[model samples]
Target chain A: MLDAFGQPQSLVVLGGTSDIAGEVVRTLAQRRCRTVVLAGRDRDGLDRSADAARAAGAERVVTVVFDASDVGGAARAVDDCFDAAGSVDMVLLAVGMLSHQRDELDVERTREIVSTTYAWPAGALTRVAARMSEQGYGRIVVLSSVAAVRVRRANFVYASAKAGLDAFSIGLGEALRGSGVAVQIVRPGFVRSKMTAGLPDAPLATTPEAVARAIAAGLESGAPVVWVPGVLRWVFGVLRLVPQALWRRLPG
Target chain B: MPERTLLCGWGRTAPTRACVLAPEVADDVQRALAHADARGTVARGLGRSYGDAAQCAGGVVLDMRSLAGIGDVDQVTGEVDVGAGASLDSLVRATLPSGWFLPVTPGTRQVTVGGAIAADVHGKNHHVDGSFAQHVAGMTLATPTGLRRIGPSSDPELFWATAGGMGLTGVVTEARVQMLRVETDQMLVDTDRFVDLDGVMAAMEHGDADYRYSVAWVDCTAALGARRSGHTGRAVLTRARHAARDDLPPPDRHRAPSPPPSTWLRAPRRVPPHLLHTLSIAAFNEAWYRRAPRHRTTELQSMWRFFHPLDGVADWNHLYGPRGFLQYQFAVGPGEGAVVAAVISELADRRIPSFLAVLKRFGPSAPGPLSFPVPGWTLALDMPIGPPALRACLDGLDEAVAAAGGRVYLAKDARLRPELLDTMYPRIGELRTVRRRVDPEGVLRSDLSRRLGLDRGLDRGLDRGLDRVGD
Candidate 1:
């Protein structure tokens, strides 16, 4: 169960291989989170994250195979993960594939990015929300991006997919208001991780650890949406109002 | 299916949704218990608990107020059978006119009889009369298995467990309580003002035994703006005894015992959020402390004025505003009064403003494993819930409290961590054993029980087993 501080004692990380997700698991483990269920596609990466959690004071660590490419299998994978660890107090959704930057949209690349960033995640989250509502109490933290606030010209496909995910998460939270289940969305500007290894750093770029801290704070405060560095909350407020003519000229 | 209702404790924090069913009869309670799902069912009364003790998320909450009925008081024995839903206000009104009063009334007379027993509430006179359960002779409890009439002699384990068990034992349908006989509705109260924590502590230790009721109001905000002496625990102490018929003024000598008075004022339903910050609370504290007479003896005051001062202001908790407040009350053993002092100093140093801080000396604890009070000092403070430092500050205090062999009162607690539950209540295993006996299927649970991990021993043990596997 989550304590009054909103710290969960047991949690499931859907994208366990994601750097931000791994850091969150380790941080929570140190904060007394005992049981960890890490589900991702990479076998070796899942093992590494599980070991990190175990060393960080998690008493029980379980790993499950989950493939974002197989959107149809999302619900089944989530069920297996929850069944492997009964009575989970929290679930962190942190799966995404940053498509290679290109001037012209490739039909297949757009499809892959949308599937990984939006469709599969939304499917898995819907299943998790249903299970959590039945359990009577749980917290769901989804790692979105500042790009979701307003899709950029350079990475429109990835940003637009995130925009869809961000909307879905907010809507789901409102739907589960009285179910003793809460959903929190984390929007980080530019996080340094494996997925963005070679990308040019965006303004207000942050690290995985910083994003983890923001998630912890957001969960504690029961905030519906949290922005990394916090300033981005205002930064995006202004960015969203910029005229289309001016926005198009801004560099990525 | 009944529509879910959002419920919060008196402090109005951590609200949860539950299917609240008003049970008019014992049969209704039994039916609800039998039909309870895995999320579980618990009983609720006037909801005076400061936290989640009465709330069960996504489960059934049997509203026992429908069964409220006060039986005739035994003229000679002073024992009255009361339905769990009956409020102390109603009980006092029924019996006080006949020269009898509730033996243990909390600061508010609004709590139901079941809530009083479930929380085993104590009042200014706890040092003399013990908690509410001490005065209860017997009660009928509705469990998932069946209904049972239990007392100190018949099913002593269940009886004691039901007391201060936070309703996890079962839903108390009715109880026979032993009220105290009094001469009048007035009290002869003595008031004293102290400039430091040590002065009041010494006074209470030596003088509390001489009075039937005693309590001290410490100015926590005063501690923040410490005087040159660096004394942070300035306080106003009041001790009282029932005013005999002859003690009253000439014209009122022949007056009959009256019921406790009703509220004279009510806080508005809505107020601006974060209205009671440090500046405002500090000013209020200063005015309150200065208003009390330095030393006054045998001042005749009404029962309501003397015992339930806050009750005179209806919904006074609303003054804390939309975000609500947290009442942190904890008790420590004798010779550990320094822990109380340390906590006051810590709050002062951290600049965390507390509006009302009450200090009292407690008598020996009751038999209930989870009963909060012991033979020692207990302090309760009310703080609005917004400070970023508040959580960690209170966490540090919890560690101090556990180390000092003390425990936070579950009824008023909203944020106590689970790891220290054993250290705080060593006999919790006994509670779990009795609970497993009465509710083996775990059909009885509350948000407090779940948050504190009070109802999941087997699951916790399984985690320990997994720990072994990992090793």
Candidate 2:
């Protein structure tokens, strides 16, 4: 819950080890956010995030094992996180995998990328949204990418998965309207996080802290959509209208 | 179930989103409290508080308005059991025909019964009748432990703790309060203008006791020329009392006394931000001071005109524009009245525009530990927020007030420092002990509580001993 200053008391980060998620949790903790639940696949990584949050003034830090690829077990993972924390004021869905487009020619690799990026997260967030609705209030912040705006050939498989996740999150937000739950879709141009480490810097590359700040401001203002390096919203608006041939020729 | 929504106080500043649930009954409130998340829960009434007292931020806010249900008034005792959510406006409308009125009403009647009690609001009649809590007989509170009935006699400690407790103790569900009987709905007013702050203070000190209600509007922006003639901080003082039937027109005298219309006018949808700048406010103050009669008496005035003039202008807060404004109100004992003068002069020296500055005299303090009123002089002013020096000026005022053994009204505070809580309310430790008994886990909290460190744990051994003795 957030106090009158828009400071949340407890937060549940699904991809706790992700750089963006860590930054968001750290920022909130500094504002007197007391409880933090970190859920991720790596115990050591989750411990590191929890330590950082505690140092940032979090009173309690709990870590739960979460594997985004375990589609069938996603709901249980969410339930475990909530059960450990009691009631979570916010849930950040920050799990994503940027698979190499060349490896995506293999059907298994494509399925893995799509499932990890979209199917699993979509299922987990749907269950979390239901709990939030039952609890009467919760903010679900989904970290989508600007890649969802247009699927470039260089990273077509990853972009397509992001597009699907983005559509699903937006639709879920609409469904949860008036049910006391809010969904904030974050589309960052290119955040320099571990997932995007090996990739070349994009035109409007941003840092994890910048994306975290955007999320914080978005939550404060109750903005439904947030564009990190906010000019991306307008740039994408124009790029989407470009001719198909010209759009295809543009490199990543 | 609660829904995420933006909540702000009357000041319309620093809005925060929260999960708000409008609980229609005591049971609903209890259920909501039970299920409140880690951020805890706080009860909110009409949102009339000028600051963060009602906002819980990220926590569940129980909007008590849905619980509004006014029971029948006890004609013999003039006592009524009103739901915590019931607004004073509705109470006035319901009781006026029966020749009864709220014992105390603040500048506005939009406040809820719970809010009136939690804030222990004082009115123009404070010098004569005291504050709202004095007339409260008893109340039912939904505590984290359970629902409990408390009163001055039944449980003096807990009752006083909850009174002006800022909803930190628990949620008040219903209260039995005594109302004053009135002969007519009108007031026979006496208006007088003073050339300077000293003149007004002397007049009020000498004559205010003659009337049941008195207030003075001071102009803090007057120039040095006015001061040279002993006319600095010129003021208009109004004193009034409920009119007798004979005081009304013959036609109105024969009819039953009725409450006035809720609102007579509304402000425009939007007011330009610059409309309330120093120049405009200064002009308004000058005109307002000059317009009042030099001296007049036996003027019949409607309740709306006499009691709540600003209520007529709906969304009047928007006049301050998007940044909103702050209302800084402080009270110092009668001996320290000089502090009031110093503050007004400070504002004038800084050229900080205050559209409305009111000065009043309070008779005595309520028993509530955190209650604002004392036998003192209180000054309240409204100033826009953008001034760079406003924060420092207020901080300086806080120090001056503390040094003078005065305190700012928590109901109107948004920026008070935490360390000054002990200085402002010396008995806060007692309130904390009582709170531990009812809400040991601190499930009931608000943004104001966190900001002031009001929820910090006390000596555990002492608290446990108190709890055991009570049990």
Candidate 3:
């Protein structure tokens, strides 16, 4: 269970191999989170992340194979994680793909991006939520992006998928009200992690360590939505008001 | 009119918004229930319950403070019909002057009679007198169905269910209680300072029956204090009995037995930042342990000073800061004393400071299925909630307590899991049955009931998630 300060004793990371997720787990483990469950498709990456959690002072670490693109198996994979851990106090949903700018007509790639970022995570989160509701309390932290504020011409596929996740998370928080379950949406501008290592840094770009710190603070405050740079909340507020023609004309 | 209000238990955690209605009379209680929306209603007193037992979120909370009155005491029968809203403080003041005292008084006098019965609160004298409900002669209950007068003899099932029922049975409007007769408003207390947990446990087990009231204050920080000096788990044990008038010192022989004083001091209204911590609490514990006399017998002390010392400071809960504290209280049977020792050791070893750790011996429990006390020892620990290690520590203790056939006090609980409720209290099924009979539509619900999933049917799943997060 999450303490009054919003630090969970045991947490599960859906995309355990993600750089941001690994950083968050290590940070929380140092804060006395004793149990960590890392689920991802890469066995070697999951092993490495689990070792990091152990070295960071987690008393127990469990890893399960999870392929987010396998939407049909998403719920089962989630159940396996929850079953292995028993009662889960928090879950970090960090599964997403940052595909490069591509033709809209590349239907196969679009399907995979959408399913990995939106459909699979949404299905798994719904199952995780049900388990938590039955347990009577839990916390869920969903990683989103500033790109979700408005889908630009570049990387619209990835951005639109994050937008769907952002909306779902907000609604989930409202739905769990008074039920002792909470959902937090974390929107980072641009994180210099494995996913974006080769990409050009966006304005107010941050490191995985910085995003992890923001997530820790957000969890402590039980904030519904967290912006990594803090300034981006207002940045997005104004950006959301930009006219479509002007937004399209602006360079990436 | 019902007004939206945020309410929490005495520990001051898990605050939830609810529509509150102060019901001055019995009819008002009925009206509030009738007008209650989809969210049900529950009665609240001074809200001394440590958790959400009295708080129904997004629902109606019938504030019973207005149902206030004290009937004329029946001096011959030693019985009094007191309003549910009448606090033990007021009742103590009124009756102590008449040489009649409550049979059982918890650590605080601020608790309302309704709350006392609802939680079936036990005092240091529980080993002899049982809980508050054991002394209840009869009670008037306002349920969703209608008003019903019940008592242990007349309706044992509902009467016992209502005791420690956490207000789910009904809103107890009035109760006739049998008070104990005392010679004076003073206590003849014996204080013994023990060097460790075993010394105190042995003394209490052998000697508690000789005294009417017994309690021990354990200095949990002494595990660290011991390494500095050589006293491990030091504690101060006090056992007391009502003093006869002749026992008083000659200086005040002519004075009449006085009422207990109201709050003489108040805690800070706003939380002071990091006011309590391991170092500060260790210092306090060391001082407290040293302050007690090595051995003192027949010391004359005011009843309130002996029983409700914390009452001297009002709003003391604020000292824990804005996050408040968690009061984890659990009881284990005779052979389970090892669990008690283990729990204290765990806290001491972990350096998790508990400002107040009370140890008491309990007699046979009352008939209430949910009554916390059983036939052995119980400990109550008050710890501030911010420590990252606190939750896992408590969760581990919960398993230990349950494994030893012990159960945590629901009144003092906020985070107990649902799966272990059955293991701890097998008779809880009986409580569910009684609640169903009285409130079939589930008109009474609280955050506690919802969290424990108490109102739901039996056949509870035992598949609990890993509650214990170790080192």
Candidate 4:
């Protein structure tokens, strides 16, 4: 215990109030983490998230809500947000959006989905990873989609977007393997989140609570990849055998 | 070395909770050198040095006092090899019976030989022996290359560089430092009093050269017409050393007896200064100066009692009454003697009154790049922190000092801005260049480095919108 030590130990969380990010904030409290700033757009949501994080455990939690949509050269703003974070340890990017199956069919809609799902998280996490690596140790979590494994016509746009993300996640994990960090890729089949509240349930659906639990477990174990339903790894293995034409007819 | 950790009653020099390291023998010191991974490391015996000189912020501070196995002593030549971590008082206690003594002892004997060499400490006798560094004939300072032995002649540059390098150059282990053959464990003394600021400066310059030891005490109360020679100076010059039979100098004067980290703060808390005013300060000063032994010549006095008279009180820094105090010590070189007089007169004019004013003559510059000594006169005074006015006064003084080509001591600094440091020490870049060469990755970092902008690495935003002003 560093109770006898006088100086404070600093920490930075990248994903600004991401559920898993929030949990990490709570976790480091036992180690006496002094500074925690959650960055995201939803001030109300982040405030609630930080409150929940503090309630769980955190010494000093802060909020720096940001819009990662790159509205006006968003990369510059994201970079600026990082400078404000000051010596960040982990950047939990929980800013991704999920598009409905029908609306994502439009090219314009698909582009938005692709950027938010894959491009924004990828660009930001890479920067965060590079910084943490230089500091000697870093922890990052890139939430990927299991729909990416075998795309069906019912959800091709969403699956296609996640496909790009899944590839980037794996590559980042490999790149950061020995960089004093263990990048954890969480593939939860379906999480009943605020976005999916009125939507129909999918197979092996996990509650946000369950997803948070699996991610916390994976991060602590330094696991390379985590499948939320536990059986999806095998189910996806079998789904690979399905022909594309037949797979197109199945309900997502 | 004592078996307990000590702090001054004010927690300065008294042992508090002592710890004993497993016998650190030859192998321990050698292995420690290999184990340490930093830009540079310094051995710390007792953490008694006035400033961060003993505190390695981002670097390692090897506790040399832990290696306390005494070796054989040469009675004829008065040659002895002591552990680096061993305390000065312990060394003195062992050598005194044999009529041998450390040639130079600073204000406190609690400091380690390793620390003394690292800081190049000087005592009242500095006008004679120079400093502890001059007495060190040979040293075993660990470096990246290996533990190499060095003397004044063998690579003299590196030796002197390490002498006052504040442990930035390398880690000092055991040293073959020179010692003085003494008549006894006593110091013969004389006292001279000066009525005014000019009188004090003249007295020190005219008479200090004739004696082996010299120092003065001045009253700080800004009382009109009631202070020391209006800023009095008390000087002592000791030439004869006491015989071997004199009682051992009281155990390390600076040692803290308990855990009183903020005695300065605690006392002020108890007796808040809401009642203290200018008149009160004047009354206190008058009482203090009246008690001094004026125009007295002592037949004999212990070296510790004579030079470090204040050490007996422990944590005397607390008497400043808690908002804490700033010990502003600056010396004016030959060309800038007028700068010294100007500063003193300015302080007097403002009625800021110094409770502790000391004047000393610096003989020569040390080898370290940033060591704070120049040939001329230096003055130090303790000011009880007050308000915005205090900041203004210091700012004004800083400008005057800079104009006079004078510099501030890094060890005692509390509120210097990053920009001023660059101007004060033009050679700061040279030290930074040496730092870069030693550890290019910039792993050796501290709050001081960040505050002072030491490694102003490429701003990450330069590639993007570095143009944004406070965006």
Best by DockQ: 1
Candidate 3: misplaced stretches above 4 Å?
A1-252, B222-232, B458-471
Give the per-residue lDDT digits (tens) of candidate 3, residues B1-471. 345676788888766667788989888897776665545789999989998898875567888988879887899998999999999998878887778998999999999999999999999999999999999999999887788899999889999999999998889999999999988888999999998889999999999999999999987764455535744467899999999878988876657789988888999878674687777777888888888999999999999899899999999988887778889999999888899889988887777888868999999999999988899999998888766667668879999999999999999988786667899989998988887787766788777776676866722311221222110
lDDT of each: 0.87, 0.84, 0.85, 0.57
A90, model 1: CA deviation in Å?
2.7
The local distance difference test score of model 3 is: 0.85
lDDT of 4 by residue, B1-471 (tens): 224221211112111121223326545655654654432234556655433343322234456667654455577766677666676777777776666677788766767787777667776666665777777778776654456687788866667766655565556667875677765556567766555656667777787787777776655455656543454333222333342333334553223222112112222334554234456766666665665556666456666666555555544555544344555777567667777777767776677756556666777766555556667766676565553355457667877877777776554443344456666766665555554444343333322333344445423211122112123
TM values, all candidates? 0.94, 0.72, 0.74, 0.55
Q: Which candidate order results from sorting by DockQ in descending order?
A: 1, 3, 2, 4
Q: Score the docking of each candidate (DockQ).
A: 0.36, 0.06, 0.12, 0.02
What are the per-residue Cα lDDT tens digits for candidate 2 across A1-252? 443233466799988999999999988886546779999999999999999999988887999997777899998898888877765678999887886758668898888888889998999998888777655467899999988988888778888999999999999999987655789999999888888888899898999999988887776556789999999999999998889899988866
Using lDDT, rank the candidates from best to worst.
Answer: 1, 3, 2, 4
Error of 1 at B362 (Å): 0.7
**What's the CA RMSD for each of the models?**
3.4, 7.3, 8.9, 17.7
Show the colliding residue pairs in model 1: none
lDDT of 1: 0.87
Decide which is better by DockQ, 1 or 2: 1
Where does candidate 1 stray beyond 4 Å?
B222-231, B458-471
Highest lDDT scorer: 1
Which stretch of 10 consecutive residues in model 2 chain B shows the poorest summed lDDT?
A: B462-471
